[model samples]
Target: MNYRIILALGAFVPAAAIAQDQPAETRDKTSAVISVGVDYEEGSYGTDQDIRSWSVPATVKVQHDRLTFAASVPWRWIEAEGKGTIVTPDGPLGLPLFPSETQVDQRIVREGLGDVTLAAAYALPVKVVNLSVSGTVKLPTADEGLGTGETDYAVGADISKTIGAGITPFAGLTYTMPGSSEGYERKDGVAVNAGVAAQIGKRATGFVAYQDSASTSDGLPDGQRVATGVNVGLGGGVSLGAYGSAGLSAGAPDLATGLRLGFLIP
Candidate 1:
């Protein structure tokens, strides 16, 4: 599953405003943020085939003027089981070597470092609207069998407008270049997402978003998801956030939940 992609998108959503359109005088010349979070997800690929994973991710971001740099690293545990049929030279064979015809059951459990991600963004602020562009790189860091073991690259652009009392509506589009490792074939793809954020109280904001991505490989289905979340500011430059998402397509995870705690420094 594309857990890293989801995390990257989540990181950008709430912080988009802070990095984009604040008034010049109120903005800090240099600032940094550190965050730690956890994510859980389950995916069902077919009947009797399913996978579950849990991840703990930590991120650091630094901003100067209109440019921002960020990185994230995660530790992940994954468990998967499936029953399938395999074809042999002799003929189609049932798995598990059962007396009766039945599919074979295979299972795996692994835990290790997930992929590491590095990213940069630049924003152009205007009176009523903001435009930003970003690029990201993914490094293979996990065990070979547990990770893609390939470097990935992506670039995206976002446009947002704030209107009517702290309500911001934003849209973004991204294109990714996939990489391949031994025994693997990767394909390029595109993603689009849109959302709106609204101030709920003096120190809280809420948002809802939708995202869709084209299939990145042959035989894979396109994916879609919807998410809702809130960020609450605590005293002393600390904040808390929670979010949940549901899949709208066969290729997406059935459910995902996440929580984050963050600190900012000026």
Candidate 2:
């Protein structure tokens, strides 16, 4: 999975706030946020070898009135073994042929900066519903093969409604424009996610979400994931959160986990 996508998904949770019915003059507030998190995932992309990755991402967000801006950067480590068969089209019968019995297995490890992402969002409130529209861009910063060397872009929207008991249910849709690399071709795709978040006591919240996406490249499969997590307020405008996700498809990771610390400035 792409580390940049993971970061964007993380951002969606806290950023999808429902606007309360307040006086027009009091609906706007200026705030800033800083968040740091570490994520880990392991999966086999329909291959025999297992791929594992770890990332530490830090993000800064500023919101004023109805506009929000965010930027995120991450340091990532990826490890995998290259033991799969190498198919060649130069066989005698014009058929693809695998490597002979003389090939050796290789281990690969890459650790360095991951992609940097920037996003802007605008919120519109209509009665009891809040709608957000956002756009994001991913900059190529990782090592040659560690990340997609091309820039990526995406546009998305979220709709949320705050019900009674301090519970908010939200749904989002995103369309991604995948970038092209030297030897790979990408396809545009869409993803959908829905979840409900409920306040637990006065300073804590719990949430459960489900996400599904279409294939973003040829030969890649679609994905489904379910996640549950909790955020606990630590006072002083700070909070800590932990979450875990389970993949429900071949294209998704088997399991993923993360922890985050966030600070809000008003």
Candidate 3:
């Protein structure tokens, strides 16, 4: 089977599913708010796999009343030490150091603008709290094979509902397009995203979210991921944040985690 097919399915489906039932709303012109956050993560690529890695992802968001937007760019470096088998036309070939084993010695390093995502959201005035819907597109800025297998673009919608206690639950999905740049084949598919967030007291906030990239294409294995982190409000309108996530299944790699810490001014 071809990896491109897998990449397409794994990348596009879930976004389609989540965006189908969203309601439109008026744009907000309240106050323009800005936030910046950074995260750092480190762990073995998978279960007991010999590969280990770390990353620093930074994100920024701007929001007014009915209108909101966000962007994130992550820089990563990986080092591993494990044996992996690579298949060939003749048969299954086992390379003692195919995957991570030999890479660690040479300090295989991959770093760049992992992926650039841009999103816009509209807020709907509900009774007590508020509800918002959003859409995003992912750009293929990183090397899929050498770095992370990020697709070309995705379109989807998100819903954010707030409760009495400053707690909100958000869910969304997007359609992704795999890059068709020659050897860099990726499955174009739908990806689903969901999460919850809350304000802790007066100076802190926390959130947890998950992304399932399955339906986009059939060429690659299933991609399931989760993320969680916290942010704190500093005096003089400044803030800091950090978060991380790991892949549960999807034999693509052992494990991939991330962390971020940064400051934002309101």
Query: Which is the leading candidate under TM-score?
Result: 1
Worst 10 residues of 3 by lDDT: 87-96
Q: Count clashing residue pairs in model 2.
A: 0
TM-scores across all candidates?
Answer: 0.84, 0.84, 0.60
Candidate 1 lDDT over 1-266, as tens digits, reads: 11122234353232222234445774558888898998887776323557777878898988888888888877877766665521100000000110113567777666777677787878766555678788877777665444556777777787777778878787787787767655445577777878887878788878788877776655456668888887878989898888888889876667888888989897
lDDT of 2 by residue, 49-108 (tens): 567778798988787787778888788777765565422110000111122243467666
Q: Write the per-residue lDDT of candidate 3 for residues 1-266, one digit (tens) a residue.
A: 01111111112123122111122342222323343323233333222334443434455655554555666555544444333421100000000122343423333344444556565665555554344455655555654333333434545555556676867776665555544434334455555667677777887777777776553223335556676666665676554545556666542233333223334334
The predicted structure with the larger TM-score, 2 or 3, is 2
Better of 1 and 3 by TM-score: 1
lDDT, candidates in the order shown: 0.64, 0.64, 0.43
- Candidate 3: C-alpha RMSD after superposition: 9.6
- Alpha carbon deviation, residue 72, candidate 1 (Å): 0.5
